[model samples]
Target: MIIKEYRIILPISMEEYPIAHSYTTTAVIRQDLALGDDIEISKSEPVTNIRLPDGKRTSGHFVHKVYHLRRQVPKWAKVLAPKELLVLHEKTWNAFPYSRTEFSNPEFLKEKLSLRLDSICAPDRGTSENIHCLTPAELAQREIIYLDIAGEQIPRKEYKAECDPKIYRSTRTGRGPLVGDWQHSVSPVMCCYKLMTMDFKWLGLQDKVEKYAYEAERKVFCQFYRQMFCWIDQWYGLTQADVRAMEEDTCRQSCSRANRPQGLFGSKSAVLLPARAARLVPESKSLSLPLDPSTGF
Candidate 1:
């Protein structure tokens, strides 16, 4: 059966010295008709009803939810130890609702699968001293990188230019590209605008739209950033070795029980085997003991 939508209600407490409240988030996945029969409409889960203490004890209320997804992996998950896998799994599962769980269509599963494969094949960002820093203009000139659910790089840009100026501006400030505040630049607004123009033109972003594009871009990027953070927490928290060991242990236990060899042997097999051999030797001890006593007398 096709899953039209999936919802998960999570309860969290904001209580302590500061005060807190409870809330829930919802995520949606749908089939997109426009992108052919293959496109999937997916939305990330949103969080709500967060309570903070002021002087008022606010009762519970439902908050709005927004969906977000990012197609990139951070640089941290590659170095954690094997024991961290459980944490990774737990975090990833929890963060799934907040991530890009929807596909253009089920066919996008190939893309998704590619992402997973990329995570496996991509080299870990281990302790390399080669620090590459680029200005917004420089970064915009390079390729666009797409990441997967596991926060691994799945796609690389060839010679394709930027797709959207708004996206470029947002990327420079948001988590995807430049990250952090661009306001500190020589001419924050102008610098950002120029960077956006360059990157967007390169990526094919149209400049025809005006107004709150920057703000809109910011919001979109923030959503993406949140997803990336969730992924980072998920990935850094787990390792692959632990999963393998657990699976191996489970397989061994299953095989042993299915064969029932241990039960067939019984617990007394060691003692019984020796006793049976002694009996087969014929009890010469009795005759020997009696003969010795008679000779002594």
Candidate 2:
């Protein structure tokens, strides 16, 4: 069997409303199966979108969609099978929202404004036009927060960054330039990929070796979860225990934090607790053994 991994970075500007509390988006990962002269695509169910209340109407939208295809090899093809299969092609694409919005009546806004005025002084009227836009530099400062794949380190050139081409399109429309020859170039985004090899004999399905091979591949891909957890710990200089504790605390504190209005002063007591704990814990300080030379597909 042959396996290839790909990492893709989705452009954030593609989202119609990139709000702070909006659902987190991720780039899609795809795998294709190829054997000899045949190839098949794999499919998975799409993720359900989160529903939000909008006055009297309820709205929801999906963030990601996946598709798969498969083919069965003819019995005669087995006679000329290669000793090992080769993965010839792989690709990834960005996913983004086509549209998004949330609406409420003037009464709702007036009520909130009144409450604010009673507590303090009169507050500025906030409008939909007041939405915040993240500059490229600001976006870069934020962490990727998630990745699937493993390696000590992967070069940045292997991945492409998701960028907003809409800005360029808008500029072209306004200028109406009659260019002789103009070149357009975009920056690349960094991404990482990890690969794992696991023993399949433990599953006790040797009689159905072909089916077992497919199952094994799925398991190996899912093991990318473990790899991501390890990567996050190392990147943040946090111990495994500290990471777990931070996740637990983050969930518990989210509700309270959400209740507070955006940009209001707040204590960093919750945020600093994990950082201090992580610093106190020592690193594992161990080296991993090299892959076994006898291992093969």
Candidate 3:
């Protein structure tokens, strides 16, 4: 069966299913991964062809990553806890989807797994000075950076240019390079283009930049359905009992609808009885009327 792929996303659908609908082909790639759909991943073949805002077409690559998430969240992950008492597994991309370790002692998991939740959420927007325990809202805004399939490294020249020491000192605002999902599905590529551009300056983009930037920051985000750390996918929270119930429901609903053979129509047949030479009957002392007209009393 063929699933329709659209070059441009429809506006009507975005308004209807904003959470689920995505224009980024990577979203489809994520879906394929999440559902465990049959797909052949090769380092040679790009995941999907993406059309840049300037009509330049490029292909993206998939970076396979794995994380061992706890089947059950730690009891205190919900409550307020000390920074030293918690541990996060961190994500392959250091972005939206991630898992953490569950331990009464935070340092224990780190020492055992050599893992810890990233200290900074974003370079520009770091966590509180005292604590780095990221909230679900904070995690949603994180980005999963993907390298280009062709191995074409896009550079941030604006931040990297050499400044004239004699004239002035250049000050950098962002803590480091751009991170996270820059052009993932359901996202508009125009923003990524703007971020990755050279010294080109344009007006009428402040509102748009702010708007797209916030959209890029996923609040209350989950990719459990599409990847290792799906936050809100129905299957993410499914238990053994839930699986059994689903299997039983599926069996009950399944039925064959094949057509049955029609019954043949035929004419009615006549019935005949053998004629008797003599009637053998015992006469009753009490006279009784014959019930049938053909029978003689």
TM-scores for every predicted model: 0.17, 0.18, 0.16
Window of ten residues with lowest summed lDDT in model 1 = 20-29
- lDDT value, residue 213 of candidate 3: 25
As a whole number from 0 to 100, the lDDT of residue 34 in candidate 3 is 25
Candidates, ranked, TM-score: 2, 1, 3
lDDT of 3 at 233: 37
Residue 23 Cα positional deviation in candidate 2, in Å, after optimal superposition: 9.4
lDDT of 1 by residue, 122-236 (tens): 0122111111233455444533222121222223451112322122323222322322332222121110000111111211222321112233222332232223223222223
- How close to the true structure is residue 139 of candidate 1, measured as C-alpha lDDT? 48
lDDT at residue 252 of model 1 (Cα atoms): 36
